[model samples]
Each structure stands twice: as C-alpha cells, then as structure tokens.
Target: MKVKELMTKKVLVLKPNNTFEEAAKLFIENGIDGAPVVDKDGKLISIITKTDLMKAILNKWKMNERIETLGPKKVTTINGEMNLEDVLKYKVSRLPIIDKNNKIIGIITQTDLINNLVEKITKKYRDLKNTKLSLMELDSVIECSYDGIYITDGEGNTIKVNNAYERITGLKKEAVLGRNMRELELEGFISQSATLLVLKNGETTTIQQEFNTGVKVLVSSNPIFDKSGKIIMVVTNVRDVTQLYELKEQLQRNKEITRKYVSEIEEMRTQLLNTSEIVAEDHRTIEIIQLANRIAKVDTTILMLGETGAGKDQIAKHIHKVSKRSKKQFIKVNCGAIPTSLIESEFFGYEKGAFTGANKEGKIGLFELASGGTIFLDEVGELPMDMQVKLLRVLQEMEVVRIGGTKSIKIDVRVLAATNRDLEEMIKKKQFREDLYYRLNVVPLYIPPLRERKQDIFPLINFFLTQLNKKYNFNKVFASDALNCLYEYNWPGNVRELKNIVERVVIMSEDDKIKRLDLPKNIIGSNGMVVTLNTFEEGINLKETLDSIEGKLIKKAYDKYGNVRAAAKSLGIDPSTFVRKRQKYINNIDAQYKT
Candidate 1:
C-alpha cells in the first residue's frame, strides 16, 4: 500500500508565520499530533508537532512567537509515491505527503497507521468467528478463497481441503483426506508439511513446499487453540508459484537479451553520431535489398549466391532478423570447414557412444538446434558427395535420424545456404547433386561484389573509419586522393578487403589524414586495370592476351554498371552475347586457378 492510500487528505496546515498559540489550538481541536508548516504558496517548510507546542509552553516563550522559530529549518518529508511500509521504517511520529511541487498534500500520523492495522485484524477475526459459527457453510466459505486452504486435525491428519488445494497441489481430497502429514512426508509426496510445523509449534508459521508433482508453493499454517490452549486444528493457506518461477526465468532471459540489444544500440548510436547511413546508391544493390525485404515474410529455402566478402552473410542475417523466426536461433554452419569424416555426424548429430571420443550425452544437431528458426549453410558447395546425399534426404524429409539411433526426429528449420562457388558448374561435373541445387534455390538472392557498386565505397570507408576510430580512440579522416585510389582498385576480395585495408591504414599511418601514399603498394600500382602481361613469358600468347583483356573490360563494365544486361548496354554488346563471354571469362579464370 502507498502513502496516499493511508494518509489523511483533509489536513490542517500551519503557515510558517503563524503564532505558536494559534498552532496549539488547531492541534487540540483537530486531534492531530502534527501539522506541516508551509510558506505562502503551501510548500512544506517544516513540521510543528504537539511536542514542540509543549516545549514552547514549558520554556515560557511568548504566545505570539512564530511556530517556524520553534522547529528545525529543514524537515524530512516523504512523497505521496512512497510505500506506507517504507514510511513506517522511520522513527517519525508523523509523515507529511509532499507533491512534486514540494507542497504538503496529506499527513499520516502514528494513530492513522495503528488504526489501519487494527481494522484489518478485526475484520479477519470477525470473519473467522462467523465461519466457525456456521460449520455447515464452512466448506463453501473456504472454497471461495482464491488461495488453496487445507485443514488438519490436532493429530496432524488431513481433515478438509478446498477445491483450490487440489488444483494447486495436484492432489485430490480422496488421496489426502484422513492421511497423516508425517506419513506423506516420509513417502516423499511433499517436501515438508506446514501442518506438521504448526502442530509442533502450536503457532502460526509460513513455509515453502515443493510437491512431487513439480508444483512449488508457499504455505502459511495457523494453529487454532482450544479452551485449554491445546492445538485443535491447523489451517494452511497454499499459493502455487510454478508460473511465478517460469515468469522469473523468462524475465531473466529477457534481461540478458535486453542487455545485448542495449550494447548493440549503444554501438549503433556511436556509429550514427560519427557517420552517415550504409551507402547503397547502386540500383542493383537497392533492388536486392527491396527483394530481401519482400522475401523476409516467406519460409522458403534461400540460396545466396555471391563472391567471397560480397555481403552474402549480412543479407542472410538480415532476412532471418526480419523474419517471423527472429526470436529463435539463427545457426550458421561452415560446410567447408567441417572434416569429411565427421560431416554426417556433425549435421545429423550422434547418440552417446555412437563413435569413439563422442560426448557421454547425445548432442543435438545444428538443424535440430535451429528448430522453428533458420540454419545458414555457408560455403555449402564444399560439402562432400556422401554428406550431400544425407543433407538432401534431410531437406526432402524434413527430419534427421541420429547416427546409431533409429528414431527420426522431425525438424522445422528454414534453410538459408550461401556459397561463392558456382553450384550449377559443380553439378555439371557431378561434384554437386542436381536435386539439392534445386531444393536450395527456391529464392535466390545474388549480392553483387563491392567493386561493382563503387558508389558504396566512400560510405563504407566512412563507416569503417567511424568504427575503427571509436575502437582505437583516434581521430582520423581519409584524403580525397586516398578515397579515389580505393575506388580505382578492382577489389577482388570485395567489402571485407576494403574494411581490412582501411583498418591497416588507420593503425599504420601516423598522420591524421589517410593519403594515397599510405595505401598498400599493390593498390597504388594497379592503375584501375587488370594485370595482363605475364612476367614469366617472353612473348604474349595473343589468344590468351585477348581473352584476358576482354575479361578485364567486361569486369570493369560490370563493376560500373552492376549487371550483365547493363554492362552489355554500356559496352554496346548484345545481352546474350555478353553473358556468353562473361561465362567464358569466368571459366578461363577457374581453369587457371583450379587445384
């Protein structure tokens, strides 16, 4: 209960300028121990108590003496928002309820607090007496209580229990009626009985009890004394706290998640204070983001095809973040990093002792762990043929059977697979399954390489600079020439490489401004063109040279224009013809770099 609920609102106030004689008369007539002394505007200045009035009379002070002169200049006052129980902790006889403007609104004296407590106790006594008088109607009255009520005889044997008791303890009266509390405790049905405690103490006691049915409850037991002061009955009130415990656990989890979200928001706020928004001026990039937004509502499998460091992973994370399963786990699996020997067990999990050195307890697989959420398979093209077959079955059946375990567990995981490698080409070589390729390509989102979206370079640099500057606690800005040089680079490694280069320059350079000279040697010499002439050869292979030159031109146009169709338009080449040449160029590079 709050102070406002108990405090007397019709209070007589004493002005600071009021005479002590006048204050004494008001206190006598109102029967209030104290009154708050306020200024002309009614703001509390100090309190004038009956004790102060008595002291003034004893000292033989003048009747015309100001009340403010008798009391301390400053007073401790409580706000209306304070809890009554907290206010009672202080030793003050009277407490003034002050408002936000510091004006006295109400007053609570010792008499008010005592009266409230007495009223409650009297009501409870009257109800109990009435209940005892009507023995036939006792059951109906007890059953009306929201809290579970149980009654035990002097011998600590169950006599009566309300409907709420059965629901709370999950124990029916037929099972507990006439049963001894000690016997039930020994049988492990209840952790401990409040009735047994009250019978021994012959007084009121409160105890926490956990039942065998997994219900936790707080039981308050009161012993009823007879004419000889002997315990005649033990009345216990039970309050189930199972849902309370669950709510507490959930609150703890929410607090942890809130902490993480707060940290992220702080970091984002710092970035926002330092830099502009993520740059995506390129039309293709805009279209891709829009498509991703549209596709976030669906639960279809998505295959994100892009070059390494082209923001494919970021796109996948965004999709899952905005999807319905955002609250669930988003597990990322690097298919290429897992060993061929353990791929099956890693994806499908294994039972205990399924293999040597396996965990004693069985482990859940990534798919199972990501149930009702999403599973991102990174570098999925690297999965071996054997594992590919198993993964295909999981995708088709939506279930996984643990190794050495016969039961097939159903899974409801949304698959989001990403790979820089060309799965269609791998399929042609019989390295990737054709069926798996189709299954994962239900919604393909291709992220263009960073080099192709050169407009985004400056913003990305600013973003990285803001992040790195905050990290290293340095003030750094990029020179125009340096930014131009970054724009000129072919960025084979895409945005990831740009971020690394920015960090390297920031850490290595001593100057506040990053100049072109601070850039790496390779970037300085690239001159916005692909390297063509082979140093190892004396004469250029004309066919190889022409193909290399054409590839570079196509890459440059594609970088500037964003897609094959646009690149073809800018180059004055047929869209179909440009695609064919682009494929040939890629095939040549693959052949040259193949292991």
Candidate 2:
C-alpha cells in the first residue's frame, strides 16, 4: 500500500498571515494537535503544533501575532507515492503529505498506521479461531448424526463406524472395525458392500444391503481424493428406507382418489354452466363456453371480443360468476360512458377535498371497490391514451395510488375486459398501447354473431318470450312461420336485436299467437321467400316497396356469398353496381331506423 491510500485527504493548512488566535481555534475545533503551514503561493513551508503556540503564550507574545514567528521553519514531509513502510522510518508523530510539485495534499499520523496493523492482525486471528471450531464441530456432528456413518480406507479396509452404523446394521464397532469388506461379505456378515464398489470404480456408489441379523439398510459411498487425484478414503452414509417404500405405495393410492374427486367436481361445474342464462346449443358456442369455464378457476385476465350486442357482457358476467372470486363484488364500468377529464379520479378514487365539488368523505375507485373480486371494463378500447398508461401500471403492480394521496393501496382484483372495437387494429393506428393490449388479451374469447350461430336462435327466442310473458302476466307463443323468418333473417345487431324483436312481437301481437306478419318489416323483407299482393294491403308506396324488395334481395345474396364479386354474379349484376346499391341500402336502413 502507498501513503496516499492511508492519508486523510481533507487536511487543514495554516497560512503565515493567520493570527495565533485563529490557528488555535481551528486546532481546537477540528480536534487536531498540528497542521501544515503554507506560504502565499500554497507551498508547504512548515508544520505548527499546540505546544508551539503554548510556548509563545508563555513568552507573553501577542495573540494576534502571525503563527510563523513561533513555529520551527524546518518540518518533516513525505511524498504520497512513497510506500507506507517508509512512514515508519520517520521519528515524527505526524507527517505532511505532498505531491510531485511539493504541494501539501494530505496528512498522515502514526496512529493511522498502527490502527491498520491492528485490524489486519485481528482479522487473521478471528479466521484461525473459526476454522478450528468448524473442524471440531464437524467431528461431533458426524458422531451424533441419526444416519449411519461408515468410513473405509482406499484398500477397502474398515477404518471407522459411528454408533448409528452399529445400531442400524446390528454390528458392533469391535467386530467390524479394521476388517476387510470382502471377508465380511464372504463370512455372511453382509449381503453386499457399497464401499467395495467405490474402491473398484473410483467413484461414488450406492446399494441396498441386508445383514445376517435381518436388518436392511441403504448405503451411499463417496470417495475423498488427495492432491494427486488418488482416493484416500471412502465415507459411506447408511439410511433405513424400509418404511419409506410402504409409505410411497400409500401415497399413490391417495393420488388416485384425489383424481376421482377432481373429475366429479368438474362435472358439477359443467352442469352449473348449462343451467345458466348462456344458451350454447351451437358447437362453436359450446366450445367457447367450456374454455371460459376452465379459465375461470384461476385469476387470469380475459378479453371478450365480438360485434356489438353479441353477448360479450353476458360472457364477462358469466366468467365472474364462475370464478374463484364469485363470492366477492363484481363491478362493471363502461369506459366510454365516463367523461375523459374525470376518468383518472373515477378509476383511482380521490382524497377528501381533492378538487372543487368533491365529496366530503372522498370516494372509492372502481379498482378498490372491486378488491378481492372482479372488475369488468366494458368498451375498454375507448379508454384515453393517458388512462391506458395508468391502467397498465395498476395491472403490473397489483396496486393503486389514489388522487392526492401518497400511499399506494394494494389490491387483489381480477380484470375482465370486453370491447366491440378491434384493439389490435387500434394498436397499429397508435390509438392503443401494445403492451396494455397484451396484458388484457391474455385469454381472448370471441363470441360469434347471431347469424353465425343460428342453432342458438330458437332457444334464445323462446327464453326471451318466456321472460316477457312472465313479466306481463300473459301467455304468448310464436307461430312456426314467425320462428322460421327469425331464424333465416341475418341479424345485424346480434343477441340484443333478437331479444328486442321477441319482446316487441310478444307485446304488440293482437292475439296469443305471434304470426309472421307481426315481425318487423325489415326482418320480413330480408328473409321472406315469396312476396304476395297481400303484403301491400296495409297501403305502401309503389316505388318504395319495389326499392325495398330489390335491396333485400341484393343483401340476401351478399350475405350468402360473403363477397362482392360472387354476390353480384349470383344476382346477375356487376360488382361496382353491387357496391353502390349496398352502400345506398345501408344508408337508407340507418335513416329509417333512427328511432
């Protein structure tokens, strides 16, 4: 080590112009006996001490006089780059340290070197003491161990055996110690020897051995190597595992029983889902429902994707009802319904008096209210960009910080988000964050539109009709022709539209039976196979009636073919004309149904 490493870098340097009183005050305040003196150009001149100051005081010298007049001009100094051993050769208690330019950089005292020497000596002593104790404890630990410990020489001669070995093998140390393992095995004292195997292979070995006394033991032998890579000794650990084998067989039986119980529980859950409000007669819908049920057992985020009124909300609620958190609260929030300016406060809540017109007791955010439960974010795609960042943080950290509050509240909430908008496309357009999209889309569930799952239409219609009849205290039924039209019509609005139509016909029909004529005009025009003069008996315009019929036929072809070119060809028209007529009809439909 060098002197610079041990020296104190912050050194007090006195100047020739400083008064004796000033030098004395610095020495007293800093708890130092001496300091280096420098000239005006900061060159080391000498060193001064309290003894020199006291001698000057005894001589009745003025306290305001310069300190340079009292201290000796000659002083000892050392270079910072010099070895630390050179410091010991000096007679002085304190030495001023200088750089290559002979300028004082630091100061070193004899006590610093002494203290460093003492620290090194103390550490070495502590290490030796710990090593000695460890070796003593190792021997005691081996002797007191529950498992048998047997040691043999490289030549397979028994060297030592702990009390546990004697007790487990039913052999005393006097009978086994110093005996060759081959002789013991040939004499019928043991069935086999793990130590002999280790000596032959020069590696660790294990085997099960049976003693003549009918005691069974499992032994593992590990070889100890010398510096020349030759085995010096083999240490064997013996354990009694006869009871362990029996316990393993019992454990296998228990696992089989547990599996049977799990299968029964799963069957019960499946039955519960079938009895719920979700109608899953179609194969694709049934598969989706099964997947939702399986994932509901855990706390994973699920994103429901489908067209508007496709029962996305119903699926989200179903997930919550079947989840582990079913007993807890299920809070639903429409991201699009909340105002953008107040979204942050509404999501993370706020402290009392956070802003103007705030509630006096503050408010709990949706996340906090749904802690230990579930939160369904409907229309999640409509969240603002800024709120998306905050939501991502909450999901990642599982905690939320309220507005105007410093403390972060921990929450255990499972998130289920549903959106009619395409979030992946929104990510490409820079409207949604890619990372947030991945978090919410851990499990993507797509609910098919009503047109795709026609098998479910009749069941859902009957369900709605029954519900409406019960509410109105009247019995209502749909005619066969009406049910056929509903099944054939391409429902653009999905389940929500079907429910509304069912309720409308049930209440407005003049008789108990709802016939095909009682259905909506749009539905009849779209699905009716034959147009009769009786259909116009209610007094319709000639031009409007003809235009409506033509538009419905074009739409029907487009729905069947699913492409502009093929749909137009089927109707004996050009693709361009098909596009034009489709756009016009869509506009007219929107205008006519604006209520």
Candidate 3:
C-alpha cells in the first residue's frame, strides 16, 4: 500500500516570522508536535517542533535583552522525496513537502512519520505472510510440473530451484542458487532478446530452449520490486513444451520413412512454381502457374514442350510440388547441358574403370542419390541410345547395376519425363525408342508454347520487371510504347527471352515509366513484312493443303540447310519423311489430317 493512501489531508502551519510564543501556542492548540510556518502565499517557510517551541518558551525569546534573537529561529526542512531512511538520517521532528519549484508546500510532523512507519510495518508483515503462502503453493505445483522452476534475486542469481530444474540442467539446487542466469543457458537456452529486455527494462521474460536430452522447455521470470522501486527478486517459471515440438518433428520423420517404404527407387520430380522464385511474369504466364498447380496433384510424367524461355524447368518443379511427391526430393538434370559423352555414366552408375579420372571410391550416381525421392531429367531427349537402353533396363527391372559391380540393386521409384522435342515423330523415324515412348507417355502434359499463351506474355513481362525492380530495389515499370512494343513482337525465346529483354529495358530506359521513345528500336510502329507460316487465304482441297504445307516446310528446310540431305537431317525428316510423303501423295492423304 502507498503512504499517500493513508496520509492525512490537513496539516498545521505558522508564518515564518511568528514568535516562539505564537508557535508554541499554535502547536498546543493543534494538539500536534510540530507546526509548519508559511509565507503570505501559504507556502512552507519553516517548521516549529515541540522541542524547539519548548526551547523558545523557556528562554522567553529574551537573550541579553534581545527579544527576536533569544531562542533558535531557524528550522530544518525536508522534501517529500525523503523516504523513511532519509527521514531517520535527518533525525528531524518534521518532514517538509516541497513542490518541484523548490518551495516548501507543507511539513510532516515526527508523529506523522511514526504513523506511516507503523502502517508500513503492519503491511510488510502481511505481505511477507502472503509471499510465504504463494511460495508454498508454487512448491506444491513444481513437484509435478514437467518443467523446473527457479527463484532468483534481482541481480539474476538463482536462490532456489525445483527438482525438475535439477533433472533438466543436470545441476543441484546448491549449485544453481547464487549462480547468474548466463551460466544456466550456456547452450543458448535463453533467448538473447528476452535476456536483454529483462536486464534493461526489468520486465518479465519467457523463452524456449532445448535441453541436452533434446527436450524443449519454456523458461519465464518476472521481477519483484520494493517500495523504493528497486528490484528485490525474480521468480522463474519453467514448463516443458517438448512433447508438441517433438511430435511435429516425429511426423516429418515419419513422412520420410513412408516415402522410403513406398518407393524403393529414386524418382526425380520437378514441380516448380512460377512465383516460386525470383523472376518476372506476364498475365498468360501467371495463368500457366495456376494451371501448373492444378496439374501438380496428379502423379504423372508431364512433357513440358516450349521454347527456351517458356520456363519448362519451373513448370516441372511446379508439377512435382503439387503431386504427392512434394515432400520428397525434386532433383533436376539438364540433358541439354550435360556433356553427351558423360551422359550415360552420369545417369547410370559406372564400373570403377569405366572411364578415366572417375572417382576410385565408387561414386553414387544421381539416380542413387534420388533413391525413394525424385530426380529431374531435364532435357531428357538428349540421352543417346546406349544410356537409353540402361534407362530402359532401370524402368523394366526396377534395379541398378553399378559400373564394375555385378550386384543389381532393386529399387521402387516414379518417373516423370519432360522434353522440348517432338518425340512422336522421333519414334516414327526410329530416332527415339517406341518402348521408352510408351513408358514415359503414361500421362502426357504439354506446356503451351509462349506465343499461343498470349495472355501470359504481358503479365510475365511485368512479373520479370517487378522482379528486377525488387532485386535491384528499383521502382521500374514499362513505358506505354515499350509495353505495346513487347506485346506486338513475337517472343521466340518465350519467357526466358522476355526476362532478358525486360532487364535490358530497365537498364536502358531512363524514365520512372518507360516511354515510347525509350522502347527498343526493334518494334516502333513497325510493319516490317512478317513472313509467318500461319497465314492462309481460304481452305484449299485437303491434299492440296497437305502438299502446300509439305512443300513449304521442305523448301524452308532446304533453304536453311541448302540441300535435301542437310534439310532432311536438319528437319529430322529421315528417309521416313520422304517415304511418308511419297506414300501420302500416292494415297492422296491430306496434310491437315497428318498428325
């Protein structure tokens, strides 16, 4: 309880110049031991105590015939800031009440001070009893709590601790008490944020930690302050939160176990999200992302066919993430990127002497690393027939035979294949295997080429633009003309090409928003003749249309390669294309129905 809560509202007073006789009589009339002298403004001037009044009256204010200077006239003063200790130190009969302006407002008598002391003493006894009771209750609860408890002095030295603390910290009560908290959390059990706050602000703090046994626990403490606003002690509360935390960890572990048990082989699944990383996006591209999410849930081999910039890898990753294998490994292997000669060795394990400079300690292949997981074979069509045979064996036997090793390791795995090639035609021409085709064609998914997904072009551009902006912290946007230029042009490289273009645009364009003048010189109101293969006037006879398309394609192929052999080879139109054409012309087969 506060002293003010029990203090008297009224007090006695006398003018500073009042005679000793006047002070004595006022003190007597007030039935008090002291009287506060005040000025005309009712502000405190001096205090006349009983003893001082007695001295004054005894001398009769007459010393060598000097009435005003006979007895003690000066009075000792005290401010309200003085606590019980300060009052005791002064040994004064009265305590002065001073305003912040340094003028004494009133005085408190010795009797008033004694009255406050009596009340405080009474309250302290009650508080001590209450604290003892609370401690007993705490002790009772601590015996059974999963967490240990500790009581520390204001300086953060432990004074007491529960048995749980003994078990958790591996420290006895005798060892912990009087020990600083810093020593208790050597393993960083207590958070620095919490520690700093408690030290600086003397506020309560709680933190989570992992003990040596790996059990998680929460430690909390609050400061106890004295009437003088000094912290006297801190009581700490500890509770174990390990059960819940461990449960979550166990569930994740169980998932890994399930993945292993379900698939004895390694499967590489790449389910990439367009928004999954730092990049740009146009509207059509965003739609593709949403579509990819829709396809991810199904476990199937998705064939992503698109130009280089269409983000096929991203699409692949998106599919894997949406499928049940989202939690497993999503490894990526770029067939186009790997060396052709090393492709077989990389996909399937090699014998110790299979090749020069191979690791002496039989190295683990990607297929092995992706055991019970995923291994993305990006640009899969690049595999030569030799590796294709090995891959076929893996699919057929569900096992792997390491190079130089005779043992065949069986495995269960899912396969998701993707390529930018026209595999169907490759199969017809005997370039790609038919068996492999059937195996990989379990669920065929195609990423619509960029141009056809026109809706995604702008949004994809903007997405890339925004990516560049955030990455570089630049508030860059496209100019109206620049945007129109992008929309008007054909994106041959697709999203990848657009991103590079956007990066170039951001660096070259100067205004807050790119303007028409800032647009690349490539497409400025430009109507350069665009010779696309898509244009047509009307429907010709079916055979005529087929012949026309075949002739145009053959011519384009010839012009590009400068001869039939080179054109056929460049167009992958083996003897098959010529042979098929002969048969088609003979049979009068229409080109529109060619596929």
Candidate 4:
C-alpha cells in the first residue's frame, strides 16, 4: 500500500507562534507524541516533540544561551509528500506535511510509522482470514446458496467459483477455473447476463438477467485494483431472485379472485366501508366490477368521475390492492378539504418557516411520501385554480418545488384522481384547467352511482350484518319484512349510508330478528308517502302502487345483497324489476341515499 493510502486524511498541527506551554497542552489532550510547527502563513518548517524540547532545555543548561536559537539546529525535517522509503533512506525520524499554499497539514514521527506498520499487518491478517473462510465455505454448509460467488484474474481469466457459479455456467468449477470466460459465454448477450457489467464498463451496475443455465439472478460486481490503480480483479456476488420475483408476480396477479376483502375488525372502520354487503344483480354492475379488475392491472393515472359517497375511495383502494404498487403506500388527500392558502405545501412539501406556523424541521408532503407508489386524490376537481397551475407543473415536469425552496425534487408516483364534481362543467366555467384535466384523465374510470348499481345493495347489507356480528359479538339476521323495507327506500348516502344503516339496525334492534319497525323512520315514511302521492297524483290504482313499491324495495334489496339477483330472490320479485328500477331512476336519485 502507498504511504498516502495508509495515512489518516485528517491530521493535527501547531502554529509556529505558539509557545511550548500551549503546544504541550494539545499534545497531552490528543495523546499524540508531537505536532508540526508552521509560520504565520501556516507553512510547514519543522516539527517539535517532548524529546526535542528536552534537547533544547539541556542545550540551554549547557551553554547558558537562549533556547530559541537552538531549536532550529536540533530538529530533523523531512518532506511530508515524499514516500516512506525516501524518508527512511534520508535517515529522518519525522515528516512535516505542507500544502501548496504552505499550510502545515500534518506531522509524522518514527513512532507513527511503527504504529502504521502494526495497523497494516493487522488488516492484512484479517483479509487473509476472510479468504480462508471463503475457501472453507463448502465444509461448513450442506449446500450453497443460489448466489454465484466467483473470482476472476486481471485479464478476466476464471480463477475460483462456488456451486452457484458452476450452476450458472452449466459447468463444474473444476472444469471452468484456469479457463478464460470465453468458455462460459452465452448465446444471447441480453438474456443470460453476468455480474461483470460494472467491471466491463469500469463502473458498478446492479442488473437483472436470466443466466445461460436458465436461472434468474440479480448480480453485483466490485472492482479490485493493485497498487498502481490498474484493474487487477473483480469479485462478483449474485443472488437467485427468481423466487422473490415470483412472490411479487403472485401479489400482482389481480385476477378472477375478485371478491372484495375489506378489513372491518374495528368499530368505526366497520361503519365506514362495506362493499361486500352491496348486492348487485344488474349486468352493468358486473361490467363495472370487471372494469375495476382491469383498472387494477394498469399503472396509468385513473380519473374516477361519479357523485360523492358512491364508494369511490373503496374503488381506489381496490385498484391499489390489486396493482403493482400494492406493496407501497396508498396516500389519500382530499383536494377540497385542504385550505387554499396551504394547498401547495399540503401537496408538494415546505421548508422550515416556509410560512407562518410551518413545521420547523420541514415536512415531506404526499407527493414525496407517495414516491415509488400511488396517491389517491379525492375530489381532484375541487383543487383551487392557483394550485392547479402548480400541480400541472409537477405532472408535466415530474418534479415538485417545495414551498420557499429553490430546488425541485423529482418523484416517481402514480396519481389516482377521484371527483364527484363534473370536471367538464368546471372547465367550462374556467374554474379548472382543461389541460390539467386531460393530464390526469389518462385512464378514465367511472364508478356508477349506488342507484345505478342498486343490485349491489343487499349483498353489501348482508356483509355489513356479518361484520357487525363480529364487532358487537352478537348474531343478528334480517327478517323478510325488514329486508323488504330496506329495499323500498331511496338511498341518498349510497353504499356508505347503507353500511351505517345496516350496522345501526343490527345494534339498535331490540329483537334478534330485524323487522320493518327497526328500519330507519325516515325511510319507512318516505317510501310509503312517495308511493301514496304517486298513486293519487297519477290516478294510478293500489295494485300499480304495490308493484311500484315492490320494484323500489327490490332495488334496495339488490344494493343490500351486494347484487340485484339475490335481492329479487329474497323479495320473491322478478330480478328484472331491480334492473329496470336501477336504470330507470339512477340519474334522478340523491347520491346521499345510496351511500
């Protein structure tokens, strides 16, 4: 090793003007033997030690002269930049390292050289021990790991290898070593790759490839250099990443196993989302469910357009749970919920004191936190016009400029935007930028309102009842009459409302079996009142009103049963009535009633 390589980069020094009293204190505190002395310009001239000081003190005692004059003659000075051999050949015991600007950077003593020798020998011993351990790996283990461990010469000649290396080359290590890598060359350059790409390019690279032996490996190579800085060897380590990769593949396989699996072990969480309880029988609802599966497969931006409280967040999470980004964070932000004044910071981030009451240590926003993943922006159309400009800049630039920060930080994130507001109307009013809308609407996904998917209602209700059973530790079943009442009412709050209503009925019902009386009072009165009014207003008969009421109740049952078919079965009404009602009044129904 070169002397510079062995030497410490950080050194100690003393100013020439400092008296021995001051220098002695530093030496004692640092536990070093000596310090290099420099002039006002910090130029290295000489080094002083306890021995040198003693020599000066003895000389003064002998000649009765000032010791300052004796200091120059008694000290030995060697150039610090010179190799160790030069100093030893000159018979010097000390070195004074000086910069081009003449600052004294270090002092090297004979004692320091002896200490460095001990350190070098110890390091060499450890390295040799490690090599011995590597050679003895076979004796210590039953089988080798999938990773290929190999060594190559300066000219790229194979020297040593393990079982993994033999497996990767389709040849035994004994048959390959002492041979050039040409003997192990593959037919395809891009396919069966090597860990030596870094060695070939004179830089390190971690890459994935299929080996010639038909195994996939993730490989890394580190270059080894000789004293002259020439490339002498390369040590490559590879791990078989096939099993790990397959697990990832398994997780991303968003297929026909399409039943929603929302966790509801907690109380508040149970009331919030209950997709499985929604029974949907309409063919359009099935189409949307299939579409949800398709959306989960793509990484492109998804724009969700629908009325509020229609299970948009649930759909967004469903998409995330089935996508490639499922393992990463699924950050949610309501553009409308953020104050206009703090919108930029909420989305991009901000520096310390970026504004009044700003976080002191700086905070990473959803965009940064969502990097390497996805962010579901709820009600994206509600973003203020000014923030829209900033968001558009980020989407276009693929970077974010934090509030009060000059530098822009790039991020890799898939955005999912959901909104109840009609973006087209907002665009018409110039409240939302059309350019931004187009950028976000890369893959448009429409989550039909609950009224449209009324078939999904009953299944949802049943699912919620089971969920409530688990929560309150009570068994509760819906009676035919109660189920009928639920089916008849208009759902203004959509699936969210239905789930809460189911949970409320399960918990509040005095009897084990739910009946019409246990149904929410407003729903009971409103369904009958509307039917009575229509019967009188349209000069319709009681039979017509009963048929109409049955249609409405069947649609609600469809929503509760998680589809229309099951609800029709429960109501003893034809399934087509649920389908017709959903298509017939979906647009006019209040969104709040459905949720």
Identify the leading candidate in terms of lDDT.
2
> What is the alpha-carbon lDDT for the whole of candidate 3?
0.57
Residue 5 in candidate 2 has what lDDT?
Answer: 54
Residues 1-595 of candidate 2 have per-residue lDDT tens digits of 4434535533344443445456546654665444444433324344444432212222332333343333333223334343344444432234333444544444433233233433533333244325454322554777899999987666777756778888888897767766789999899999998888898898999899889988888899998765567776788999987667668888998999999998986675477465457876777777777888899999999999998678888888888888889899999987755666788998999999988988989998999999999999987987878999999999999999988889999999999999877787779988889999999999999988989999899989988888888988878899999999999999887888888778777777989999999997878984434457666455546766677788888779866754455677898977667767765564443333334
Model 3 worst lDDT run, 10 consecutive residues = 59-68
Off by over 4 Å in 4: 1-282, 527-595
TM-score of 3: 0.41
Tens-place lDDT per residue, model 3, 37-116, is: 44323243454543321222232222223211222232223333324444344443443344445444444344333344
What overall lDDT goes with each candidate model?
0.71, 0.72, 0.57, 0.62
Tens-digit lDDT track for model 1 on 176-218?
7657899989999899988888888777999889999889999
- Clashing residue pairs, backbone N/CA/C < 3 A, model 1: none
The predicted structure with the larger lDDT, 3 or 4, is 4
What is the per-residue lDDT of model 4 for residues 424-494, given as tens digits with 9 covering 90 to 100? Answer: 87799787899999999998888777777767777777777887789779888999988887777677767
The lowest-lDDT stretch of 10 consecutive residues in candidate 1 is 52-61
